[model samples]
Target: MTQPASTRRLAVITGASSGIGEAFARAYAKQGVDLCLVARRLDRLEALALELAQQHGIEAFAVQADLSKPDATDRIVTALAEQARSCDILINNAGYSLPQTFLATKAQQQTDFVAVLVTSVVSLTHALLPGMVQRGYGRIINVASMVAFSSGAAGHTLYPAAKSFVVKMTQSLAAEVADKGVLVTAICPGQTESDFAKANGTDQLVAKSNLYKQTAEDVVAIAMSANEAGREVVVPGWPNKLAVAFMKILPDSWTAALIRPQAKKFALPDPTA
Candidate 1:
């Protein structure tokens, strides 16, 4: 049987089937927080929910929805209402990058990317934040990336723009809810050990690189700690922190000149090829 929402804290984690989202689910479950795991992969989500619930003795359930759909947020909200649960913590972590140039990909694909990376975030947050604010307690963690600070890159053109939006949105929301006991944070992680590369078909390229990579667990741990401490933005690891620092210190033109060539390697091959 499920417990009343007032008695136990419930956290809604998007993209909770794997990677950083899964890490967050496990971390919060260990702390006795009931979980509503959101992901498009029903099998993985169900398996994870069952494992966590059994291991931690917490109420855990999976909600399968593709965030690219505009109605996805509404469905999640409705599910929570059906369960008589209100979100105490929300993790807006669902995202992916298109590895092609703007002209190389279909316009529909671009819109879908925006839907998942930007619109879903804003919609979900908007829906759940009211309940959180009214209860005078909430935690919102928006997973931006270290690229959020970059001026522009050749491939994954929209990724940085979307992440930048998340960072700015987090800051503004944090300011507004500072006195309301709701904590909003944007966690900016660099290259992480996750399926992100594989999902975008860059696994080989990423694996060949010698760049420092943080594990999903490490990223989640830092993000949780930072949110609890009322931090508005955090870069998880020292290497990522240093990188972000340089991006901020260097002139935009200089950074763009340095980043473009490197980023081009990850762009998708020409369709005509």
Candidate 2:
């Protein structure tokens, strides 16, 4: 049944089939917000769409596409426009690891990664910002990583660099759109329990439970609150917050040293790197 429309907002979550993105969809639906969930997996997205609509009585639109492609951002905009849907929130959570160093990743693959990590965010914002500005209402959450503070992260260089761009860009956008009631947040959490590592053959990264390992639920909860409260960037846990603080206090070389082995464990074989 279509629930009576209220003042509740609508959100579009990329990578919504599983992991953090899926959690965000569930969380948002709990609030009775309309959803347009996008991901490469059609069956999974449709299942989620049905679940959200049935469980929360909110509209759930599903879009299946590979956001890592160059045309992905345009496709998202076009799809939404076709449905006459203008989302009040955008959660950019579709990212995976390279499993290699910058030099190891093929040029084409690197280019695609760059498109997903940087260009997609930019394009989506460009497409949606005008409406958000006009309405003075919007929330944009760009997901980033814990490695953004390091100099030589050893193996995962390009991924961190890309994430750093997201964090900085989102922070800047938040300041610019503050007065207009458009909120932007960069959710930067480290050592997450997600398939991102497994896809890259770096699943061992999460094996270290002795260290801080945050759940997708926890990370998204922090981000949702930060979005509501207008906090620009949110690193979910106490330990991760401390880690970022320590990185700030330590020398770049020391930070590199601290991150070396883990970086090595996940290093993609980039001979050039």
Candidate 3:
């Protein structure tokens, strides 16, 4: 049965136009949760919001904002206020990898990447967490990656670093709010079938690989379960779980050596070449 509008929870999902973000939005809508879908693609977000609201009998709206911009989170919060809604759930899922070496990319590009991957997560959570604390109910899920546990590779230089920050931040925040009724979790998924690879220009290479890839739906399901159970961190599939375990058990230097060469394949082409 659909929950009454007054009692239905509102979830704010970043990057909701596609991939894992879309998956989370669909899952929450099925449970009768209203949605604020955030992304740069206004048209896609509007279509998704309309479709989900109609199909699920819930309120859903699109908030177009580029998280790389400093003002984006403020705009999102303002939009929610305009709708008279407070976030009961926040999914910090907006992220991308540059696939270029640190020095090869312009400083502005690196900063923008960090803004989306790190700054936005902290900013959005900071803005909405107080209300959740006051209400004594909230769920926050930070979508990290299996690489969070792995050592840094040559390319996609900041990807692992940012994700590691997310994992640690989730753990710390979850500990702080554990007794206050707010659940925080970091879902570190392995290679999943999504536009993530395509955005990073690795889709074809990934497709040709034999490595296991989880569906975005499965990743989100695991994330939702973990958050509800108050788990601090979770890796979706067993293969991913095993990989994380190995990274933890192995020496850092060993893991770094193993990962660097393989990761170079996905790196952007040399600028001077």
Candidate 4:
């Protein structure tokens, strides 16, 4: 792997071993940006880094850490400090969904979900923001989901709620940092052909949906462009955008009634089965 040019900007991406994070890595590398790739899978991260480095002729470093752990942010901070790296862009894309209903899920799994989806995002952003502010330039993309705007599913109760927090937080942070040459955006993509379903053991449920699906590359393209253009929230596909818009006009009771029947189809598989 070639050394990155000192003058090139650096992007730190989480959940970068696969899916949308991997897409972001490819996009950024193509643009000649150096990358710091983080994920729990060290082998995958290293392979991705090597491929991006060789293919794009840019530097790519792999940092393996599980975002759900309390010390995850600290590990990232230390890695950056040791490498004398300061992020020009940060993509908080590490996450997983739980298909089981809140009550059915283990207590520890629920807490870990919160740690990965909420606490880590907040801490990592806070850790990186001071440096961005000092540099007077930064970009952030929080990979939220289309579920943020609607609560249709019965299981995975916290998924939509947690994503809503990300959307709102991104909007609020964008307002504060926009004037300072920093852009913060929430990328709310609908069902995309990523490891999302497989990771959460929802492949069967996802396969039953008639909704349109997108490629991770396509979704990340929309996200990265939206971040660059300073959009607070970027919903990738037209179907997703329209769904969210439609949901906005419907009352909670109406939507809930509509979703009740569908909930059976979307229900998490019994673990014991």
What tens digits encode model 2's per-residue C-alpha lDDT throughout 101-129?
Answer: 66766788888888877888888788888
Question: In every candidate, how many clashes are there?
Answer: 0, 2, 0, 0
Evaluation by lDDT, superior candidate among 2 and 4: 4
Tell me which of candidates 3 and 4 scores higher on TM-score: 3
The TM-score between candidate 4 and the true structure equals 0.95
TM-score, ranked from best to worst:
1, 3, 4, 2
State the weakest 10-residue window (summed lDDT) of model 4. Answer: 264-273
**What are the per-model C-alpha RMSD values against the true structure?**
1.5, 2.4, 2.5, 2.2
Report lDDT (CA) for all predictions.
Answer: 0.92, 0.82, 0.93, 0.90
Report clash pairs, candidate 2. Answer: 99-268, 100-268
**TM-score of each prediction:** 0.97, 0.92, 0.96, 0.95
Tell me the tens digit of each residue's lDDT in model 3 across 13-36: 999999999999999999999999
Task: Estimate the lDDT of model 3.
Answer: 0.93
lDDT of 1: 0.92
Which ranges in model 4 have alpha carbons more than 4 Å from their true place? 1-5, 270-273
